[model samples]
Target: MSLPLPAPVSTYFEISNGSDIAQVTRCFTDDALVVDEGQAYRGHAAIQSWQRDAQKKFAYSVEPVGLSRNGDRLTVTASVVGSFPGSPVQLYHVFDLAGDRIRSLEIG
Candidate 1:
């Protein structure tokens, strides 16, 4: 599905839950940047490649719990269930939105 640009928190939840690399890429601007852990991915090409690698390495479900906005920044806290088993892990995503697209995303 083609989502609204910049997308809502639920949109992120859906894309992450589905682990849809294409959908995730569509949520960002052409020159967006994503920082996860200590790695940084820039632009749509790099982001798509990163997501593909991540999907293959990690099997998990991402459920968004809450969303908060401060100016152009939006933060989401989500519960993640890894395929390895055990309790669900918590992940925090901080998004910097520009116009209708995501300019930057920091995930931890």
Candidate 2:
């Protein structure tokens, strides 16, 4: 069964799985922040570049398996498979939403 996700989170996974970098960037707020691999990307331009770079660096697919909420924060646990070292891994995608857009996202 699929967990019910917030609009921004749902749209994020949709564009991410489709490898639509441009649309993915639009899923966040203007001053959005994304942290992946301990690296921080602030603002749209940085996030856009990060997505583009990551898309080129890996061929991956994510399947959201679970979710949890804490006030305005929503955490999605997803199974990811890709060309990276680990064939399959469970990742926590923690999101902080502001209004209809995502204010920050951290992938671990």
Candidate 3:
């Protein structure tokens, strides 16, 4: 599915699917915060580390299937397929954008 997303948001999915751990940090702000699996990662370094760790632990790809907005926040419903316990599952990715970058992202 293709959605008309902001540049930073679109870059996010692209880089994520590419699995380039190094480049993933460029999609966010220097002080961006990410929350996933009940843990919060603050700043680019932490977020990068989080992504690297996750990539090492699981092989997954997410396709954004739906989008919604409330104020400046975006909620993306994505279809995830991976080698994890749940081979396929729908997940929510809530993003907060800052200028042309993502200020924060929470995935559950």
lDDT of 3 at 50: 86
**Residue-level lDDT tens digits of model 1 in 1-108:** 232324534555666665466765557888888998799999978877887776678787777676778899988877788775554878889999886678888998
Total clashes, candidate 1?
0
- Worst window of 10 by summed lDDT in candidate 2: 17-26
Model 2, span 1-108: residue lDDT tens? 577888888888876676566775557998999999999999988888887787789998889999999998999999989999977999999999998899999999
Over 25-67, each residue of candidate 3 has an lDDT whose tens digit, in order, gives: 6689988989999999998788778877877888898899999
Cand. 2 TM to true fold:
0.92
Ranking by TM-score: 2, 3, 1
Among all candidates shown, the one with the greatest TM-score: 2
Shift of residue 56 alpha carbon in model 2, Å: 0.7
- Itemize residue pairs with steric clashes in candidate 2: none
Give the clashing residue pairs of candidate 1, or none: none
Q: Could you tell which candidate, 1 or 2, scores higher by lDDT? A: 2
- Regions of candidate 3 where Cα sits further than 4 Å from its true position: none
Q: How does each model score on lDDT?
A: 0.74, 0.87, 0.86
Error of 3 at 36 (Å): 0.2
lDDT of 1 at 28: 80
